[model samples]
Target: MRALGPLALAVLVMLPRLTSAQFGLLDDGLTVQTGREVHGRWASVLHLIPETGRFFPAYWLTYSVIWSVVGTRPLAFFVVNAAVLASLLAMLAHLVRLAGDTRVAVTIAAVAFALSGPAVESFYTLSKAEPLQLAWIALSLLCTATAAARARGSLGRAGWTAGAGVALLFAHATKETSVVLAPIALGWLVIERRAKPGHPCAARFAASYLGVAIVSAAAFAVLRWRYAALPLGEGWYTRAYAFDAATVGPALFRIMAWLVRDFAFLLPLVAVGLVRDRTRGPLLYASIWMLGWLAVYLPWPATFEYYLLPFTLGAAWVAGIVVGDLWRDRAVTPLAWPTLTACALLWVSAGINAAADARVQLVVDRANGQLVDVLGGLPRDSRVALNMSPINEYHFELPMHLVEMKRRPDIAFVRPTTAPGHQGETFLVTPEMANPPRPTVRIALHEAAVRQDRAMLDGLIASGAAERVYETTQRVGILEFGIGRLLCRVAVAPILDPTYCPTERGLIERRTFTYGWQVHRLVHARPIAATMRHGG
Candidate 1:
């Protein structure tokens, strides 16, 4: 257990080094210009304006304040993240001690937490508040459980348990996902009630939990009032798909595959968790918590592997309890040292693999730095469209700053023919532009001249209507194309063979939608001609 202090210290030291890594970048860094006009240190800038009702203002405020002082530098971000994770681990260690054998239980849980590779992405790279949130949840659970264990004629202890409920509510408000902990809170109340007949502490527990719930609800309502008439739950993203039993098969497989890829070292804990279905005391409580969380989250769209943090903590606690019990009972004698040695070896290997993976991601982030430079250099108002994934994936943090400054970029980079009827006119290629009733122009560029395979940018240039501005590594070339000098010669030029189409239609499809988005070449082909004939 003493070793945890040094191990934690080392983790704290390594955290700052990672801040400069890709994972260290956060939305708070980019919100510098409009950080105050929007809202001070709240995530007000992250969402579209008319924003309201994001839970746990405290969480974002803390992060934003730190980010404001630190700037967007990665190292600074890493330091904060490291501190949060270290605190979380220390809390978990304390919880393990409260539950069972200090050494074995704490050691196994620590090994599992440290060995799990995906946690590296969740805790280190993302720099999300989830680590801190989980720490609070663990601490709350520990406090409440400790109180329950001592619930022998003490209303004050129940009041202490109520404080734990308040903390849990704070955790949930920080992230909607922490709502899973509510079941545990309710379960604790039920267990306490059953154990004590007409227990005065029951009343205190109910009042405290109810008080926390009311306060949490009020906080949510206030947040919603800032955004819209409707509750925050009415948002579209919440309606996205999650997982159910039918979907669970695939989700389960996915979780397993991810574990194999990133968490090969923690296979023992996973195996133990699965094999030992029936545990007693808090171990049982931890097991139920894990299963309950999986059931609740498995079917929701929130199944991003990082959502497994709470479950991972619960499982680690359970593993620690089970192993520690074995060590104490002498049922697992003689082989204890051997088992611990093997786990230690796996722990060392896991750390090495995690570090290596982080290094690879660091290199990839560096390579992508070129894209960031190009995107940043573009006119703030001119949209630099992306064709592959949503631009938000790459520029999630950067764009919030742009939007908050009321500098909405006009350029929307999207694939043509993405919509069914709104083709050709809105998208660039087709005969509609060839003899357009109104003036339009075609822009052309060599595919290789773009220097990088940015198809969205290349396609925009190739359409011939855009004035060409080509740049090599060192120099930029600007070609002027005014309306009078340019000819609107939109013709059907195929970009892709239709054999790739899922519908199997045999036709060469030119991409759709024109530059200004004023024309969908095929759909408005007739209307545009009428306007041109009238000279309107």
Candidate 2:
């Protein structure tokens, strides 16, 4: 129990490098940090525009500082992300202890939280703001707990309260969903003060928290007004994918289903803690924290797995409380066996999911490495057109930045639209303009897009419009498992290449799962025109 915290810290410190082998600065990483060069100013990185309504000024500033110090080294970014995640995990353990959990329970729950499927995803995609948001949230909660423990009306209490408020502001700045933290903190304080009726700092702490929320809100509004082209309701990105009123019910259902599917074991423990410790102020605070995130996510237009990070933390804390109480009793009952079994199964499920993710990451890393090699081999003056998904572009951008290439000015990167009947137009790869100075090199990256636009790729190859420069291939193994069948599924799935069913007899399956990239060099005009005329 005593060594678990240190062991967890050591593992977290290495997690970024372990899981991020294939990851590169892409999407928000580029749009928010490296890609700002396209707009010719640092202000572009702020992204106050309505297209991205989530104004993360603090996040951008942090990246700017990193960029200045590290000059776009991918490892530097990974280190910072790992550090933040480790800090978040440490804070989570401290929070569990504050809730009166025993050391063993705190260690177990914190380890579970770190290994939770969603947390693994966050670690893998370290470029996103979710980890940073989690860090700020944990920090705020820790500050609130510290303030609650301080002497009434003392400077220590006041200072901790102010720190909590500042942390809350940064959390919101990292992600708009963190606005729930303010109310969560207030609720926690209310519960704590009620438990200790004579606490002199209660009123003052509440008022200070409220003042912080008000100031944060006002500051956010001013920034939005000054920089955003439209309000949240008017933003295209928000309306299209994030928060559509018409689809809220279905979205909420899907999100809930996802939670149940991923965290079944942890959810039951949380429920037990909530019922068992309902009267305890700290337990109530944990419950409120978990519920607050659910309330925010229910109406969200899209509920990505990463959105479950905060909820996972809350659940872990509650589960820790329940386990701690049980451990203190020191009695093994009939129900204890099943409870222990469920916990074991939960961890096994998480381990399997993490392994699957790591496998996919390795495949991606191989593909990205091949692409980088091909790109590096191209002529220094080549003007290449990138016709791929945003994710693929980000993968490419990271390596380019690391190598400090001067190709950004010459590269024409286009993220294809997924709209119907626009597949050909999306690539813009025609035989007519297959000449120099107009993308002499074209790369078909991302397997899904390649599969979708196979005809276009075939046409280019057949028409002699372009010659294949490089290619690479890899296979993906998909794992399927359910309750009471995980161990069987793991044992049989890899060896037999079949969907493992615990009871079903001899159900073998085979599927083609290959992903890679293909590069083509534009041919001279004469051959291209002749090939096109003959409908090659």
Candidate 3:
């Protein structure tokens, strides 16, 4: 406990930096855009738009406050995200302490939760509501535990119970998925009170919690119905999975595999803690909290890694309790070596995951920053037709860039139309343009895009429709972990052209990851030219 505060603080400082490496906003661009629009305007903030789905007032409110302070600075959002993560970790520590675990166990669990791979992704992205939802869920759990310990009919018990309900409401307001927590909490209460038949305090507390949950859920539903109209059809992203006979088997397999991979490191610790601890209440509660979320998300067609943020926290807590128990045991048992070995392996796994994440973050940050610069240079009113790959580094569409760059609303920035005879005075932006007009307009292209579409580039050059205007190369030295001199030497090869590799082949080959915004202008001949040629 004494060292817990410092450890948490250290993690708090480190989390934002790790997640903030990417330059542009990720998926949460819409929320930020809406928040900016509705800041200080209460009426608009309360109404949920059809595009964003259910009302997430808490998410909107937090967005308003943070955007108000930081404006468009990406680092500011990262800092705020880190702060939320810190608060979540603090609440988790408190929950573990309430569960009667030793200080050693509490610290281990909190650290593990902080280091969770899925949690790292969630916090790193900074745009999702999962982090905020997790924070509120932790607060709700702590409040529920506090209420369970208090005397029936006492003011303290009532206050804690009320607080728990409020926290649950905030959680629901943060994310619709939080409704699952209510039943899990109720089940926990039932299990805890089963031994004491006719226990008035237990029964009263359970009833009060249930009542609050039901009222909260009903009120939210009514508000959503009255204010937020559901979309007639779910988006392609959401409909990527649905309750289909064909997909159910695969979805189940994926869900099972994900659970196993993510929690394998923590399961042993949880098992040991459950066996050694006198009270199984905390372990059971955490397990149910995790399982409840799994049951809800697994059936849904569109569950991603970030969706598992809450589940990761529960597993961490369980592991922490077990580790703490092992530390407290005075006897040297046959299992001691095995347990120590597993813990060591878990730490190694966490380190490797963090390193890999860091590498990708570095690459994405470099790429997006360059892309923003290129797009920013274009005329504000240019009718830019973007032909970006569907699965780019950031998984962004036009909306993300428009929101981040604060482009003029009147500007016609759109995806390239597939329709024939779609000719106009447009600035064509693509990774590799085939059959571009002679003396092709040159623009910076992302190296990854160019490499992936190398054949297209070759075709354009061979047809004399494309020619390099000028090559601009940048060296990202930070990407070079070691053996820098060799990498720099290899960067000079012509096989790695300047469009994709502006610098030495070794240093710039794979190390260089950016969007190449190759600018091209379509050439259209006058109608009179065709008539004169036919007459001649």
Candidate 4:
């Protein structure tokens, strides 16, 4: 009986993932497999090191094991991600049902969440930790509820409470954002207890869970402070000293855009239902859940859009309630216009998600394979340096490393020998890196060094030390991207790189997203004296 509902949700939610290519990205995306563990050896998953300002031991361990055991290109990463995503959806629906919502409400909740902006972004990276983290967090809540209602200060009660704590710890280990759930879990236990009046209150279980949460929180705080207070990926993540005021504006923009784009049609119905929102228990729960996430996320330094996955879950629950209230009554409602409008908006959101899921396939993955072919054609022991585009965000190095590891072991991919003494060196430069936008940002970071690097690059190419051996360019311009936007509205990532997308710009200004490149080599073996002119 329960099988068909979950199965249907699985297929509905995973349709985009199933169709999109599942290769990993260079940074925190699926394929970031360089030095996954301490000294390339498998450390325990409980390794307390706060790597890159985040305590994701489970995340690191899981990826490390998969990459090491299966070699660099494990296609099965997609299969595992699909299963996790399906499980997440099933658990979400079950939780809604447990909250005393109707079956229609449960279906609505699962569908909205599965097609949300966070869902699209999280599941796009095969086996990304966000979806898995959410799954564990939900399970932990379920365990807490079980202990609160069913256990009466017995060993079984202790067991259930401990299970909840352990499950929550797993969530925190997966992604530190899950730490926010600890407080929510403690209070949620009270609500669960109140639901069963005849059963004595599980105060002892709650106290045990509280102790666990307190110890866990202190441990994470100490580890993070001792290790991660240093520099991590970008400044706002760890170096900004917990937070700065400037981060919140762009963060809110990204969050609101995601909410509106995903559930614009449903917002009206939510507003319409707001009068009764004071009385409805589920609505209150959902709203508080969303507020809890906001309380943590808005003030915190990490501003990535996918961090809003928890917030999106809360919003989806609220959406489910609104839809459930108005599913049948046209006389009462809200979508000959309400239902029809939500379906239309949902279609657009789904399209956006599908497009995001398919994004890497269009450029990076294809570049990886083509680049492999290009490197394979080079002579044995050819000295090559990669001069990537400064503006190019994707990690193109992984594929190059894979080439050296798997295919052309003799081709030495080295740091650019721009210091002037290295001979017979081939510089593989992707011209798209030289391209810059209108510089709409009023204040940009690190202006001097970046200009110097670009200028030196231009000087080397102009001096005629070497010529381009081969090149393949993929046509990617503004019009095709515009068509994509017209098809499905975009949910912008909350990245602060002014060079890529300026926050102040009025969204959608481009003749080209990027001109994709498979670069050729420039063999330059000359003194470095000729490459110092500095002009843009």
Best by TM-score: 3
How well is each residue in 1-536 modelled by candidate 3, as lDDT tens digits? 55457355646646546554543435455656765787778577666565645567877777777877887767777777777777877787777776578878777877777766566566666567888888876776677667867876889978987787788788888887787866976886776577456445445555666666776677767666676645423533344435554445444444454454445566566656567644355577677878888877754653455777888888878777767766666366566568757866756544344444444444444555565555555555555544444344333434455545556454465443222344434444445322111111112234445554454435444654444432223322222211122222344332112222223334212233232245554232222121111110
Q: Give per-residue CA lDDT, model 1, range 447-509, as digits (tens).
A: 222222244334444554333332212111212111111111221122121111223211212
lDDT of 4 at 235: 40
- Using alpha carbons, what is the TM-score of model 2? 0.75
Q: After TM-score superposition, what is the CA distance of residue 267 in candidate 3 from its true location, in Å?
A: 3.1
Candidate 3 global lDDT: 0.57
| TM-score pick, better of 2 and 3 | 3
Worst 10 residues of 4 by lDDT: 436-445
**Candidate order by lDDT, highest to lowest?**
3, 2, 4, 1
Q: How well is each residue in 1-536 modelled by candidate 4, as lDDT tens digits?
A: 66567667666665655655435434433343433433266555444443445557666676666666655553456556667777777777777766566787787787777766566666655546777777777787667667766646678667877787777777767777666665764664565466544224344434555566666666666655554534444444444424554666445544454444444655565565566532155565566667677666665544444566787777767767666766644465534365557655555644453344344234434444455556667776666554542323333443444453346656665555544554444545433322222221111113344445545556666876546676654443321111222212343434332333334333344443333343445555544433432211
User: How many steric overlaps are in each model, in order?
Assistant: 36, 2, 13, 5
| Candidate 4 error regions (>4 Å) | 4-22, 28-41, 44-53, 185-237, 277-279, 299-302, 328-350, 353-357, 360-362, 376-378, 389-400, 403-425, 431-466, 469-515, 527-536
Q: Write model 2 residue lDDT over 1-536, tens digit each, in one string.
A: 44456355636645645554543434434533454452346576466454755567766666666667655455565666666666776787786765557787777777667766566656665457778888876786577667867877899988987887788777777777777766775776677566656344445545556566666666666776786676776776655544444455545554554454456776555544555543155467667788788878765555566678888887777667766665565374344456666766776755555455444445555565566555655554343444333233543564354354333343333332222332121112211111011000112243334444455557766866567766676676645333423333444311221222225422222222355666666553332222221111
Give the TM-score of each candidate.
Answer: 0.60, 0.75, 0.76, 0.74
Estimate the TM-score for candidate 3: 0.76
lDDT (C-alpha) at residue 367 in model 2? 69
TM-score of 1: 0.60
Looking at candidate 2, the ten consecutive residues that score lowest on lDDT are 432-441
Point out where model 2 deviates above 4 Å.
1-25, 28-51, 186-215, 222-229, 239-245, 275-283, 330-334, 385-408, 412-449, 462-465, 482-513, 524-536
